[model samples]
Target: MNVAVEGRIEKRHISLSAKAKAYVALTKPRVIELLLVTTAPVMILAQNGIPDLWLVVATLVGGALSAGSAGAFNCYIDRDIDRVMKRTQGRPLVTGELTDREALVFAWVIGVASIVWLAIFANFLAAALSLVAILLYVFLYTVWLKRRTSQNIVWGGIAGCMPVLIGWAAVTHSLSWTPFILFGVVFLWTPPHYWPLSMKYRDEYKAANVPMLAVVRGRAVVGLQTILYAWATVACSLLLIPVAPMGIVYSVVALASGAWFIYETHRLYNRAIHGHEVKPMRVFHASISYLTLVFLAVAIDPLLPF
Candidate 1:
């Protein structure tokens, strides 16, 4: 009896440790960081300088909850496919760190709580938009598109793009052509941003049967699409200068960074056509830096001047 009890205690400790790691995985912290980056610029741009403290706090909390909830729900829904993918095989659901019913409950709890918090603290518009984003990501992107087509990221990008609009509406309580343009920029940026990462894991994606672009069209087609979308993203970024209150400093940054983006995409495309694989990964990593700096520039444009 003593030996059995000791073994049980050891098993319980191991189980708990695994469960903690799974919970952290469910949060998808890197994706959340990109989402927050998208939100901050809108918050900064909404006001000429910095937004109100209360609004920023509310938006951040609400956005984090919604984004985290979406990620949890995605993990729950994709557990089977996740187990097949090397990158996601250790996720909470896939590893049995959490049960399906438990994850469902967790997701809904966070989702409803986030919506309520946003509605109560932020404007109803922001709250509604957040709900729409949640629905788009969960239903349209995850349920409908992910398995059906390689263009999954294209439409799914809409869900991620909403943080900008939500942040803008949180401050202004209204939408504008400028926010829409920001949405377009992010919408176009998403494909190139994701495809390189997808290319890196194409074999994993194929084994998992996820139908990513890299899996469907092969590396050459994916590379071409990345280049095409990168060009569109750069154009959209440039369009913001006139409509957005940004000035020449922004133009200079956009021009230099945009050119680099295109150059990287071209390099990737050339490599892909030649049956090489590493350049896309380089372009993929470069894209994160490109967007982060671009949005940061937007947030700080007031101080930079024309």
Candidate 2:
């Protein structure tokens, strides 16, 4: 009888651990990590140096919560489509690891808590922008735009840009041209960044009845658009050099990384227009590296003497 009780207790513990892991998965921690990557560097730039360590910690925590909330809500709303797509088939809701009601409740709890946390620990403006980010991501992007148009990511990407503003607002508690330039860089970068992923998964998107650009348009056209957006993204990144009065490190890194990003886009375009096997994930991974390097420069520039 005691052996039976011990076995049941161990099983219960294992079940609880699995449930906790599923809850964390609902928040899409990878996406939150990318959002937080953009957030901290902006805070560093806004300070023109290191700000208070506590403030940085507070802002990062709030930003992570806010992004996590948005991601969780996205998972909940898209659970049906997620089930239909191969890439998303392992999501908690799709796997029945978490109920829809539980996911919805978790999203709301974190969403509200994020705003309140930012308000108390960061500032009102940071909190307000976080709220807007959540609304834009949940309503404008996920519900209203995603299924209706191929250009969904183009407009929905604004929500992703909000972290730069939130980061700046956390430090300075005000809006400025520099942060807006950073916002533009992200805005223009979104299409090229996301379209490559869509290209690789065009069939899945079509199967799921989602109108991603690669599904609705020919690969060549999508590639051309990616190239255009890539160029625009690089141009916008250069605007920061002048507007932010960026140092040599940022200026050089921005130019070099932006060029590499544009080159990758052109490579995609070449493969598409020529009817060669288009290895789009190359550009996709390249975009991630480019963004990380450029932003790393952003974080390092403010501390440089020159």
Candidate 3:
């Protein structure tokens, strides 16, 4: 009887773990990290070069809520395609962990809550931007572009770029060129950052009938585009030094890291030439590091003092 009781407890533990995974899936943690990276640097650059405590707390929470809602809605819309892709097969919608109605209601609640939180605690501009981000990601990217064109990632990148501008406006309550430049940094960074990973999973995207660049344009073309975008990202990063609070430390790191990122993309290009497939994964990993470090340099430049 003791052994039977222990087995039942273990079964309950497993059940709880599965439920927890579904809840976390609603948040889309990797996407949230990228959004925060974009948002935080702008917050650092706002007004006094240090974020207000209340504003920071409200923006983070509101941003997370909006991002989570977008992710959940995407899951709902892509349930069929998601089940076809191995990478997304385990998601709550695909795995039967949550009902469609349940996920829909959860997404709506989160979306409404995010806008209300931002309007009440932050400002109306931030709240409006948050709502716009959600609609752009859900309606523009997921509904209109994902299945139609290989340029989906390129255009969908706009939704991803919204957080930086939202962060800047949250404190100052208006838009400016500074945030526009930061948006450009993220906008240009998205294609190269996502394309190599798409190449690495081309078969999966093809299976899902998603018109990724790797599927429609071929890996060679995708590699070349990745390199071009990496170069553009570096150029954009350099432009920030003159406009924002960034300084020599950011410039130095941007040059070194950007060079390394370009080198990785070139390696990917060369590998694709020989019909080899593994180097794009390396390029993908490097892109993540490059973006994170560049933004970190931006966030800390005021403290560095040239």
Q: Write the per-residue lDDT of candidate 1 for residues 240-284, one digit (tens) a residue.
A: 888885787777888898899889998988987887655667888
Off by over 4 Å in 2: 1-14
Candidate 2 lDDT, 1-306, residue by residue in tens: 012474573322337788899989988888888788888899999999998989999999999889989999999999989999999999988877788988999999999999999999999999999999999999999999999999999999999999999999999999999999999988898999999999999999999999999999999999999999999998989899888889899999999998999999999999888999999999999988888888899999999999
lDDT of each residue in 184-267, candidate 3, tens digit only: 988999999999989878999999999999998877899999999999999998888888757887888899999999999999
Q: Which runs of model 3 end up more than 4 angstroms from their true locations?
A: 1-17
Alpha-carbon local distance difference test for all models? 0.86, 0.92, 0.87
| Per-residue lDDT of 183 in model 2 | 93
Clash totals for all models, in order? 0, 0, 0
Looking at candidate 1, the ten consecutive residues that score lowest on lDDT are 1-10
Flag the better candidate by lDDT, 2 or 3: 2
lDDT leader: 2
